[model samples]
Target: MLIGVPAETMAGETRVAVTPETTKKLMAQGHSVRVQSGAGVAASVTDAAYQAAGADMTDAAGALGCDLVLKVRSPSALELTQMKPGAALVGMLNPFDAEGLQRLASARLTAFALEAAPRTTRAQSMDVLSSQANIAGYKAVIMAADRYQKFFPMLMTAAGTVKAARVVILGVGVAGLQAIATAKRLGAVIEASDVRPSVKEQVESLGAKFIDVPYETAEEKEAAEGVGGYARPMPQSWLDRQKLEVAKRVAQADVVISTALIPGRAAPVLITEEMVASMKPGSVIIDMAAGKGAVNADGSVGGNCPLTEADKTVVKHGVTLVGETNLAALVAADASALYARNVLDFLKLVLPKDAAGIEVPLDDDIVAACLMTQGGEIKKT
Candidate 1:
């Protein structure tokens, strides 16, 4: 089977679908790999590296026509037009987005949305969202640290002793945990909070204090768990309580990294403009959920770290608002490697000769979990 790897076309996306290392593995399994020329360049992977791994380098159109296509994001209409009708596409197609679903269905191709990969044990290896979020979380801390005026760690200098920076992490999931760990590594006084109390242990494992807010009912608890482990919309009462607690913490923290997300829903505004105004001016707030929408007033959309206009640099409250989309792309090389491994592991169950004779068994859990649309019909949720 010839598997295609195309360069990411999504604006600001730097990661590619397949890395040279993963290409080598597929080739060793007797699978042919074709990579679009310069696909791995942003990730610092060279065309020569792909060639060395036994992957044929070609143009985007040519690569899209392979037996199977792996991509970092959904391909554009022009790119999809190049694919053969029966070709298989495996990638994070943003299934929740209506436009994305419509395009894939129109293509009449077998599409697997990695974003919909189930949380079951068998599907763990192919969980692209978790893998990417892990990197994003780690990098978010670094980004916050860079913007922060003071050092994360306390230090004794000739002048005086500086106190350790207070870091607050919201969301406490894969990304939030990683952020906590990274900040702690830098010697910051780390504290974290999440709607789900289950992650308290994970936050404390890295020596960060866990800020837990108990809910009154089972329904509230269930909603906190969120769809596919993402956060769900909270009630006004819950949000009010959360704001009161978070406001105190925000005022104390030198840095705040927010990673809370609710799938198929607008990102909840965990930090309000008034809250941002309450913080000391030099504090940094990194909003990981910025990919969905603005987390604060004057919020810029569509970047890994969206910044307000240069001239309008409202530095009054001394808070730095960071909303970067696609933080994983910042570490493209490592990100691509992890993503490629995820796709390869999943494909092992349903590709090559195995794909040849078997009509996509709709009953298969992996297939059922990720198949968003088939035979021109969108599967009911």
Candidate 2:
């Protein structure tokens, strides 16, 4: 079996799908690996390094036209044309994009979108979302620290005493939890909020305050419990209450990092225009959910804050909003290494060690959930 690693064509995508470490591993398993020249350049991995690992350095066409192709992002129409029918593709393909899946199906390619993998213990090694989100969360704090004019830690110098920066993190998911931990390490006073009540302990354990909004109704409680390890949409009543609580914190906060996002749904607004207006003049916000949120009339999408512009950092109402969509890509080297390992782990389920051909085990829950387009048809809705 031959595997290809193509350079990511998406703008702002600096991470590659495979690294020299994974290349060697694949070769040891009786598979030949072909990596396009400059595929890992952005990730700081060199062609010489890949060659040393026994990988064939090839052109984009040579890499794309393989029996199995690994990618960081979905292929473009032009790149898709280079692939042969019945070839296998694996990537962080957006499973919710029906048109994209249709395109893969039309190409007669077997596509596996790793983003759709189940959040189970058995699938933890292949969980791309968690791995990427962890990087995003850490970077969010680092970016916030850089943008913030005030010091994160309190200072008592020969002059006067300086207060520690107050940071409020919205959506206590993997990213949010990481943000809290990073902020705490920087000596910032942190507070986090989420619809799921169960994360309060996790928040408190990280030495950050959890903004608790008691569920008033049964529906709110049920929603707060969440589904499948992800937070469900909270009732409007609960949201209103959370808004009021968050607004108070935002007013006093020096930095805000919002990571709230529901899969396949518009990100719920946690910080409103009014909330932004209330914040201090030099306050900074890292909207991790930017480009995945509500689409505005002006053809721009927002994150946890409606004022946030995707992939742009701007000051509106005296608040600096950092709307980077791909924070993990900013940390390219480690992100690529982790993502490549995830791709390798996922391949274990599809590619047998002893066999020369790939096999899709439909009975495997993770494989079944991730299988998007196979056999000239879309397998996942």
Candidate 3:
């Protein structure tokens, strides 16, 4: 099998799909690896590194034209043009992007969107969402600490004693839980809220207070239980109650990090403009859900906060809002390593080590869920 690693062309995408560590493993599996020159540059893996791992360094065309193409993101239209019709593509392709899937089908590519994989225990090693979100969660806290005017930990100095920063984390998922853990390490007083009630124990275990909004009905409880390890859309009544509870915490918080996102839906507005206004002047907010939230009339999308500007840091109501769309990319080296391993694990299900060609076993739930396009058609859709 010929495996190719192409440089990511998407803006702000710094991670690569394959690292030298993974390349060596692929070579051990009787695969010929071809990596585009500088494909791993952004992730700190040099051409010499790939060569040392027995990978052939090639140009974009040589890499993308291979039998199997590994990518950090979905290819652009121009990139798709460079690929062979029947070549297989693997990436964290957005499965919800109907237009993108249509384009892959049109290109006659055997596309696999890893994000669609199930959240079962067997799929944990290949879970790109969890791996990337873990990095994002850690970075969000570091970013907040850098931008925040006060110290996360209280200090007893010769001049005066400084109070510890109050940190509030919204969405207690992979990202939010990481934020709580990170913030706790920084000695901040942390509080986290999530639609899922099961995460409350996890939050408390991390030394963060769980902001609870009692479920009013059976429907609310079921929705709060969530589906497939992801949060479902809570009823409006619950959201309203949560908003009130969150607003109280937001008013006193020195740092707020929101990681709430329902798959395939606009990120719910957890922090409104009014909430921002009530926050302390020097408070910092890291909106991890940026660029996937509600669209404004001006055609701008926000995160958990409507005031958040994607990829931009701005001050609204004297509070600083940091809306970094790709927080995982900021920590490129580790992010690439984890993502590459995910790609490698996913390949085992399709590309057998003892066999020559790939196999799309639709009977396998993980493979079926990730199969975006196959045989000149969109399979998962």
Report the lDDT of model 2 for residue 248: 98
Model 3: residue 349 alpha-carbon error in angstroms: 0.4
| Top of the candidates by lDDT | 3
Q: Write the per-residue lDDT of candidate 3 for residues 1-381, one digit (tens) a residue.
A: 999999999999999999999999999999999999999999999999999999999999999999999999999999999999999999988999999999999999999999999999999999999999999999999999999988999899999999999999999999998999999999999999999889889999999999999999999999898889989998999989999999999999999999999899999999999999999898999999999999977899999999999999999999999999999999999999999999999999999868877899999999999999987898865
Badly placed stretches (over 4 Å) of model 1 are 225-228, 294-316, 352-359
Sorted by lDDT (best first), the order is: 3, 2, 1
List residue ranges in candidate 2 displaced over 4 A: none
Clashing pairs in 2: none
Give a tens-digit lDDT track for model 1, residues 213-304: 77877777777777656667776667677778888898888888888776766666677667777888799888776657543355544211
Q: Cα lDDT of model 1 overall? A: 0.80
lDDT of each: 0.80, 0.94, 0.95
- Across residues 90-140, which tens digit of lDDT does each residue of candidate 2 receive? 998899899998999999999999999989999999999999999999999
In candidate 3 the C-alpha lDDT for residue 224 amounts to 91
After best superposition, candidate 1 residue 298: deviation in angstroms? 9.4
